[model samples]
Target: LLPGDEEPEVDLGRLLQTVYERAAYDLRVRYEEEPVPPLEPPFAEWAATLLREKGYRRR
Candidate 1:
């Protein structure tokens, strides 16, 4: 590890989710077989608001 270097703060949930997605095939992981679910409009809006509030969500 580089001296004095530090890990940047981030949303670990999203980061782990992305990593899992990329590794799913290699790991032989399978998702649920259930039919596609409807989008929760309010949840999406709430997430957006939370991200904006976090500031790191932008860039």
Candidate 2:
């Protein structure tokens, strides 16, 4: 609220962009490889987990 006060220098938008881009890139790489499904939670649960990990939280 005072004059000459320096704001925070971090750019949160760019940071999240970088993170999302990396996740996308990794997903692409995984697509190129064979699908590896876990044996514990069953196929449906594993698929849901995969989607969640790739940032698909909801419709």
TM-score, model 1 to reference: 0.31
For every model shown, the clashing-pair count is: 0, 0
Q: Model 1: per-residue lDDT, tens digit, 5-47?
A: 8977899999988987888753562222211463388865565
Query: In the order shown, what is each candidate's alpha-carbon RMSD?
Result: 11.4, 8.1
Report the C-alpha lDDT of model 2 over 1-59, residue by residue, as the tens digit.
47899876989999988987978865654433335653455865666678668765342
Worst 10 residues of 2 by lDDT: 30-39
lDDT for model 1 comes to: 0.59
TM-score of each: 0.31, 0.28
Off by over 4 Å in 2: 1-8, 25-59
In model 1, the clashing pairs are none
Clashing pairs in 2: none
- In terms of lDDT, which candidate is strongest? 2
lDDT of each: 0.59, 0.64
